[model samples]
Target: MTISPQDLLAAASHSKAWPFQEAQRLAKRLPEGKPGGVLFETGYGPSGLPHIGTFQEVLRTSLVRRAYEVLTGGVATRLVAFSDDLDGLRKVPGNVPNQAMLAEHLGKPLSRIPDPFEKYESFAAHNNAMLRDFLDRFGFDYEFVSSSDCYNSGRFDDALRAVLANFQAILDIMLPTLGEERRRTYSPIMPISPTTGAVLQVPVEVVDAAQGIIRFTDADGSVVQQSALGGMAKCQWKVDWAMRWVALGVDYEMYGKDLTDSGIQSGKIARVLGGNKPEGLIYELFLDAKGEKISKTKGNGLSIEQWLTYGSEESLGFYIFANPKSAKQLHAGVIPKAVDDYWQFRAAIPGQDVDKRLGNPVWHLLRANARHEGADAPGQGETLPVPFSLLLNLVGVLGASATREAVWSYLGNYVADADPAAHPALDALVDKALAYNRDFVAPTLAKRAPAGGEVAALRALDAALAAADPATSAEDLQTIVYEIGKQPEFGFESLRDWFKALYETLLGSEQGPRMGSFIALYGIEPTRRLIAEALARA
Candidate 1:
């Protein structure tokens, strides 16, 4: 069945995948004579490490494709992730290896640079391969295209000719629009001299299609020769952008807000190309964390690996899904809240305003969660640590007997000291419970286990627990330990030393959270069992 604009709107409202209005407009503008389909494109310049921001753009496009498919009853939609490997290296990022190599590879294809890590054949190949692997791992079914391949294949010849034809038109328009100063130096393309940073602004002599050559005179009217790369051959960046959309049949594209003027210029070029301007163009703002834009060039980008280390895949997904198309700063800490908000929205949406625009934040979170839910690590739910330290302690106190029911029982009776209420807080608790199950249940410690002295201290604590009255509550036991600790020979200092030693022996660490609380949570039996096992190993 063909998807209608209404269907897209409904899907956007329910799924919050993209801006509802934008989706609606795109759906309405879909070619009427053709069978229903959509093409979304996101491009990446593989000049450096593929940071989380790269994933954000590509994944967002993928989400839009998925949304279209779902709305169109599984009709195929294409998502293209273009790697601009032919782009010149303007600057060497600090993290890149062999910074000096950039000088040799300055104007050459990025794929020609030797891989600094020696993992891939070239620097460009290494970054592109890693990015491709990451996208594949995340289940983004994108068609990967290398700029070098496109150029060599001559797929952009017509678009290139169009660009050259409109060179004077672009110049006239740009002069009036961007002002006279820019017009004086601007050519339709940026043809920089290898010897100097001067622009070559003379009339073209020949456009040699067979030889892929373009001969032009220099500003001083000196003859100069340059080879044209085929794909949209040798056009200015803005003109080239418009040509890309027309040549590639792009239906939707997004750009960062920083490129607003370029996007506007691209739109103008689209009119010149006689191709349909994209149905919608989204402008996304930079994502900042703690007052810093997450940028690789600025050494402020957060790596995806680091994020996965601390957060669940779902949490990461939620961050992207909840953000808006508008220009606004964002922080990483906002991710958990986005996840929480998405879950709440999913729960609330069945009866809410059916036609209302779901807030961008809510939509972003839901889409992100949906996308990540499929590829997440197995047993993730069982591995996530509980959010509250007290909850973890409580889980430990319940020990091997810990279950959802047991946890509620302890929290109701001892911890919160209140009867459980059927509210959002309870839902939060359930979420924490699931996270704990995913992250902490199957603890994998490093090879170097706790030390012998630490194990002895844990054994002493276990012996003390065994000798204590069973009828005495956990609080009473703490009181007894405190009283024993007050003795001059076994003072608070000794207790601190003992706990530190125990941590080293039991967990192979110098420190951990509260010991008495930890023992109480793991339950007396499990704590003793773990201690004994650790002591034996030590």
Candidate 2:
């Protein structure tokens, strides 16, 4: 089953995967054998803790980076995680503590504000460290850089000089977008106050392009002249974004849909600064359960840890990989379906041809993680022994207090090779299923008494199970159930209706595993007893 270089080259040429598309665009942008190979960048505004959006951006960029290497025959690449900590803190994030202290520090650079959490040197430092910590845990290869450090160390001095030279050009691009009130005071350059240490929003009084200095009125009513270079001044964000692209010589960058306008504006300013905008993507934003855009400040979406509690890291990555241009709901409710989708896509990988496999979302994600996990390559979707939905339904029948050993004992009866050592991935899934059931499934479990003819149907089903041979297959048991439901006396419009009645009266769920399969797994005698108990509960 070895794939030759010819096969990979042919498949990669024909692959229409989004990551490949992005990488193809980037490969054209990068000059062949350019020094430093290639540089890909993702920006972070350290105003709040990193959320799913941050993870999404970094992971998506990683996918494209990997694709670029493959597409260009293993060209080296570097991913820079740039944190804009020098930006002013306009408003306090609602999720953080010490609101009053945070309010006092408003309008100061984030790196200058005290950490409300008391975990790091400043608010921005805390958030930036958090971003690094989370990315490290996911085995993402990246280099973290702080904006405050970049500005203060003069790494951005040449770019600052270029921005100063094109100040009027940048203004022409930006001023039209601002309201009349803001336009009156808006200047592309914002100076850090000498006395107050806040990024001043005041109108520019003078620009000294030769000296790299900007003059502005301080918040304390003092006229100030400061070197625009060396951290004394920063451009407004739109301008800053363009300046960053030039400073870092970014080859590729991607952002959310909301920033499309910003991207256009920045592209114009980048050209004005004598630089080109990096290759870019506008991905759709994630929304909360109510379909509103998820906000990091409001804590409205699932955090990485919250989602990982119910879903595997690979499942989370797969969710991110699928149709990134489409907006998705980020909440606890999406986890099970996403995990099931991960299983479904993984199952399809083995049967697919090279082109189809290249197009599969699981291929990119699994291969990346497999390499991170020190595997030669990912398997053909044999990681899990059962569908996530099936496992969830199985846990529903097992009850909230069911022990791992009890579940394993039942699993052993169903799957011949269900040993934990042999199926470690499935063993982890069992833990996830148990937690998901405990949190979401157990409380809603409300089995009810059978209505009207359902009682007769249950009795008839019990009788059929009693009469059936002990050695009957689950499929045979399923056929018997289907036949009983098809009977005119049962009054079922369809087999689906019969199954619905069975679930509501017995399992207290709207959907469940195939009744035949459940019967086989639970054993015939136990299922008959379950029917008798449901009838008695009435």
Candidate 3:
């Protein structure tokens, strides 16, 4: 039998160490059945760069869906990510190109703003595209529904009417629950404009579904209007959540710790709508390097784009996987160590003593990597390296490889650099490195080359190789080169000095993995030829 989301939830709930009490409570609240199973939903306001937190929500929900599907022997759950593009601008995000546009967009939907990136038609579209791209990159299969699309499709009409009708009931329930000031400020369905500090009045009577126009009356009974054109209509943020649960028939939803109180209030609204309240799971906020909660408006969040650039997909995955859904701060600096640990855990699990505390997922990933490592063509075993180590090596090699021949030459030198006496373990490490490099590093490297002295070092190395004796071993050559540096002018044991000179002249880093090992794996001839050519260009 497959592991299902329910089984996973059950396992999590029963575990004495499970940190999320809310998740346990929400799981208990779920209706009994294998039929009409949970519909997991996570909503994000599409206003700026979707951060790692945004991805975490979708990923977490998807994991739940996977768990359910596995346990049930069928797809028992659906994971939906709702883009709340129809949400009005609450504040101008700090890094946004246009600050003045925020005022015009106040009390208006985000889908209405001109895209600062100019690629997408609107601000919402740009952000939505970013998020879609992010999720797609992570191989997450999800149903994406945009608020603008849903509202324009008239999917929310019934729910909107339901909400409007029970607006009084919503008010009655909320008024007593909230303090006097907050009660007056709160509405049954919509969020007040945080920027304007005004209650957003939903237009009434202009309900032309065909034209997507909705008319509203101001407090003074003056005519006010907005259009749900392009699949969006004005809806209060809080009310919209309830309406979405009803309209989309969501069974489960997760929220950030900051929204715990609001999530509770939303549950009341869900009851008022005569629909089952979606199970709410509250996860803690992720903090930036400085330990402050990541906030888009404050430009304080680490973006998914930035994370992808600096870290591997597995690194990002481990970040979300390892973290408990509680009020805790996550540090960006911890990612590299996490990745290293994940790799170590992966390596230690196959045919080794299994540490009970390390758990199954770590074992699964290791076994997966091991399977991949085993499947490569025979005899090429010596060429491969560990994924992380390969990254470290490529950071050096790519500094010099400006062209295909240069890259090939670098690879040749890399192969030549390997020590045959080096343990079979080293070979395995190298194999994984090659795999990671081919699959991940090359694409990112192809986008942009190194700049400044790194490039110069590569060029210089190329020139020096062109002039060197073809038969000279990489080790002997390096020794001679280092000897030259031992001169008084170059100072004592100055590998840095030699490296700086090489980088300044060739455009590669001064210090890299063992040059002997690199050159052995990469042939001397290709290294010489490519380096010569690069020097000529320089």
Candidate 4:
């Protein structure tokens, strides 16, 4: 596991990935021979059901943690997947099972709200279970920390004392960010109401930092005193974030772009509380394809379950890995491109330098499965098969089948002479593509017409392909396809557009596999007949 410092430095300087750069900065920030392992944190708000955005934060932070491990010679690292379920329910969500029941519990901590779904003891417990289930399904390694547990078990008591002692300093850092009315009512600690059991946000009447207690005016006009330790009281979120950094000894954490101000305020509060702030990264939020923000409240984006249905989990990981800070679209349509990109990256891994190989998203995605836990070193992971997008197209072309063996037989015709079991990853992709095509791809199939010049080009390509041998080498067949696109009759500005026309007319989509390999595998005569039929209909 030991890596040379030079190797770590090379990763920092040569890689363009954000996680790598963040890890490099982290390594330098820590003093030489620091005693404790690095702690990476991602927080979830359990106000409603868990969603894809929640997964994105953990995945991004975990990637950075993995990169850090590589940089520091397998240095000890821990990722704390913390959930802020202790926070009060601000509003009733439109999507949960029983809206009326949730509405009645507004202002109560999520942990105290009864589960409308009847599956768990409380709403928070149900959501937390969803989080753990999905993460475990992806084989993510981490310790789950519930804010309620940290508070109720007295684990946050020491940090609570620190916040109480520096109450004014923390308030000073936060008040300017609030309007005058909020500033007047704001207190860094809110007591759990003894009567209604809601988290009372009323003004604090007195603070006894010396005794670790606070007195606050409740919403119903009673003055109540509660110990800051245990479940009696909890720090406000900004203060809580800083306290968690100190109590958990977190080294790095990330938040959404919207939390820029909160991060700044938390860092200042952490400094005042006698702890250094964890290094923070802010990622741009996901947007829907229509360019509107993807929000849990709006229910605008695809869910984790939906994403998994249309695409492999590794594809979703690649989508997140690409431009981590850029605002990317989270849609079902993006899944195919993600799958193709994963294959491309996996294909490039052989004989690559350490830095170049780590740049591949597959390298990070592989660690999601326990089987590939220690496969982090350079040139690791099994080779992938032909792009899943291609298999999906092939599935569409081959029509419905009674069994998967028929589909594998079609694939063997293209790959030529090699047993697919020799490539387990590709074999798995074939199974996935079959199911994905039947469920998602088949229902969308439609006939497409050729454009102005495409008709003649299709005609010529069809004739040439009819005469070409199916046993032709992939390289030679590929050259023939390229040459057909170059014909003046096509007037294509690029070879890509010509290929796009072929895919549209043949597969009912504008994207598919390499024409040479596809034609050779699918049988050139059948392709010629397919093209000629389309021409006749046009």
Candidate 5:
């Protein structure tokens, strides 16, 4: 166990974990008035049900917060999962019901539009509730802030005044980025129509910075003097983003790589507003299997619900935690490997050294629930007793109707630590694996007839397993199987072909777990029966 408490932070400072690296970058601009003080912010647009990308931002930010806490020896920090719910609803989300109702309310703030689901006061409320529910379910520590709440309650009053005061400067920063047509009508100040209540994009006729008001022609061609502060108006997207940083005193925030230009402009605007822009990272967006950027409007990305349905949430966390700066292919096909990688990392943590453990993904992944600061410690994380892929294969072997008790019986044979009561996490995985198999795996399975020397090779494997002790370890049993596959009589040219044949013949998949491990867990007798059944296929 590493007991050098004094050197823990110093050692972690050099560690290469992305979260630690991010924390290290953020360390320079530590907030004032308190030791280790900082505020981390993540923005959410309440336009659709929260997608994995939205969840990824929060999850990744939380990891950085954990790393910062470890690096600074318990720096006080706040994470605001801010919702930009006051933004106008430009289009109807296909996933939601009553599309016509949403279409009618286009150009209104999301918070003002009635919920198509009819569960909350507005569409934004319904979506924000889903966001909160998901965040709460994960036990993430964050304060949920609403844009409409901030604006309607005058919380953004000072920021609006700052923007009004520096209107030309912000416009100077934002105007050049627009095209010829948009630049003709664009104004930093967007007045909420007093008559229709829709957010208006009309050009401002006057900016009375001293009065916190802007005069603009409303959509009905009526001259209107609107209070730019409060809920009376909201700034355009880029201006509002910068104003938010100014208003909230955000120390660090993260955004998608697509917003690189926007971040630059927003940072400049924030500076013009007499507020320092927060330290931030621009992460790559999640892409679909087709390599297209996952778009909520295109309705192409996997929803949070779909991920949770097939894989454990922790597995999804594991997938998102790795390589934030790099775009990842988000699809159902990637689920099994992600599920396995999560457990694999967790299981490997205990065997690693202090520096290695600090860099290990599982350490950062579970540090939010860590008992103490140091890396070396017991009860640090929950590890799956078996690989999620194994469970998927287990479901295939046991059939769709297999229950927890039946699977646990086989699970007990594979790992002595397997316990339904002690490891509810693993128990949950079993259910997900079963569902994934039923929905995805079973339909793709194609058991083929064994031919030529392959038949002889299978017979030899059955004979060898039948003669060996049923209690043999996976490693030893693997060697026994390997030796049989290499016997020149089988006519096998490469080990790859042999293993592929095993996966196809036994599991009906392109690849599988270590044959020894599969065989050991499957029992020596059942594997022989499986070979017999394969051999019996004409």
Candidate 6:
């Protein structure tokens, strides 16, 4: 099969994600004829509230779907965001409302637990709804699946029978991987207890593969004969993973690095069961600021709500791009960089190969919906007159009380050469900067005393502003700042360090608007006044 839209091939060529490269291979291997459509599956265990890690799964899958569409010239595609709600609730989360209520439902399937928040039918449903709500809000094109429903409605009956029939083969793949104690009691099928309604993980005394039934000793010490079909039984995780791929005919998927071994075994079992195992890519897990694994239970990293509250969906999309395999810190501190980097990538797309633009994160970010033609080009949308970092700094300099209109007016004057209204994304940009300022900036905003060298440099900068010709342009003011940064006594390592000192000393933020144009906008008198204050404090 020929992958159309050469840009898709270029993207896969440059992509660091194994899933993209695997996707390219899959496209090439497709049977020549009318395509049956591509299916990508992303699974979520709704044991706790849906978190950022959950979002990453769907987001990563979406990227592959985008690549697949481009490769097939927009062929039919379906992304299944499957919820493993049938998973047992091993422990109660402390973060949810009414912890005592969840303790009552411990050891039950997550689908059976009451919604602690009293919002949905059950805990799993609540979390699943939350997941769907966010995906819908983000305009993600996906089909949601409930594992509980899939099993209850007998949709997985054939896959369940396949596992029962190949019980020893599946055991051969799993038993050696476990410890001595675990291997003694391991069973591919976990029967739902008729009395307690709990998922029973006991050892099977008899495997009637021909009859598709298994007999296991229940908690009451009774030998219960259960049919390994529908809701009565569910396969263990690895088997379940493979079974889903076969049942759904998934073409591609992505998983966490932690699951690499499980994925390998699943592939073997899938191929053995006459199922087409989906190609997958394993990405490193998200880490907190201190480099610990981001846990929904521990709440070590930014939650999806927190991220969306402070940054745009596009910014979060960019954060997941380019380095799927490498470990990266996912925290509030990285939010600003993600936002600024997105704008920078979008701004650079116009001058390069438009056909190869599918490789660019900005292309997926800005035009994933394809509401308009030529959306991949940087020139298609209103370009920001200033970098987002500057606008964020403006939030710090002007204080939080400044409204969006006020910020835009200030930007219009700051970048006098450009039209603020022409930038179509200005509204969202301003909101992001302001929200970022409130969350990560304002609480920490406080001026610090300058160093002795900084004082001397500030005095020199103050004198330059006070004595400069009134006709000095923004370019001239920028040169003055750069020249001052080069002075030896200031101990400035580079122009960047000088600017850092200036921002912290004047605006009380780590970063701010470009000082040259800022100085031009604030004028000589105000600029000198701010500098003099810093010198006195030093």
Report the number of clashing residue pairs per model: 26, 0, 65, 0, 0, 0
C-alpha RMSD of each candidate structure in angstroms: 11.4, 2.5, 10.8, 3.3, 2.4, 3.9
Candidate 2, which segments miss by more than 4 Å at Cα?
31-33, 98-100, 296-299, 369-380, 451-453, 467-476, 487-489
2 or 3, which is superior by lDDT? 2
What are the per-residue Cα lDDT tens digits for candidate 5 across 1-538? 4436567777778879888888888886672214335888999989977767777888899888888887888778888999999999998877789999889999999999999998999999999999998788777888899999999999999998888888888778888888989988898889999989999988885557877878988888989986887799998988999999988888889889889998999989989988888877789988899999887668788887889989877788889888788889898989999888888877777777778878777777776533335335675545676788878887897775577788888887788877888878788888888878888889999878788778888898998898898799989999988998898889889887788888888888898888998887878988888898899894
The prediction achieving the highest lDDT against the true structure is 5
lDDT of each: 0.58, 0.83, 0.56, 0.80, 0.84, 0.77
Task: Determine which window of 10 residues in candidate 3 has minimal summed lDDT.
Answer: 367-376
Off-target runs (Cα >4 Å) in candidate 1 are 1-20, 31-37, 119-121, 176-182, 190-213, 217-222, 225-233, 287-298, 326-332, 335-538
What are the runs in model 6 whose C-alpha is more than 4 Å off?
1-20, 31-35, 205-211, 367-381, 399-409, 415-424, 442-460, 463-473, 483-513, 521-523
lDDT of 2: 0.83
**Which sections of candidate 5 miss by over 4 Å?**
31-36, 98-100, 369-377, 381-383, 417-419
TM per prediction: 0.62, 0.93, 0.60, 0.89, 0.93, 0.87
Q: Please report how far candidate 4 places residue 217 from its true position, in Å.
A: 2.2
| Pick by lDDT: 1 or 3, better one | 1
Cα-based lDDT at residue 500, candidate 3: 51
Q: Per-residue CA lDDT of candidate 2, range 1-538, in tens? A: 3455677656765579998888888877773636886888999999977777788898899888887877777788889999999999999877789999999988899999999999889999899989898788888888998899999999998988888888888889999998999999998888988887889888885467867878888887878777988888888999999999988888899999989999999999999888899997899988899999887567697888888889898888888898889999888888887887887887787777778778888878754521453111456656466667777776787785477887787776467786899888788888898888899988998888887778889999999999988768878989988988888887888889899988887788888878887777667887887788799987
Model 3, span 1-538: residue lDDT tens: 1333454445544443222333344455542423565677888878766677777777666555443333333435667888988777777777777678666666566776778667778889989998888777666667788987887677777776676566577677666766766765555434223344243644234355445455554545456565534243445556677768877888778788888777777777888888867765667878766778776557676666655545555556566765446554555445445556555544444433222222434432221221233211232212224334434454335543433334344444434444434534443334344444445444544222334443455554555666676666757767645555455543434667555544333224333444544444445555565455445654
Q: How close is candidate 5 to the true structure, as a TM-score?
A: 0.93
Worst 10 residues of 5 by lDDT: 368-377
Candidate 1, residues 159-276, lDDT tens digits: the string is 6666666666766656666666665556665454434423344345336644545666555556667765443234556776787888888888877777788788788888887786
Prediction 6 global C-alpha lDDT: 0.77
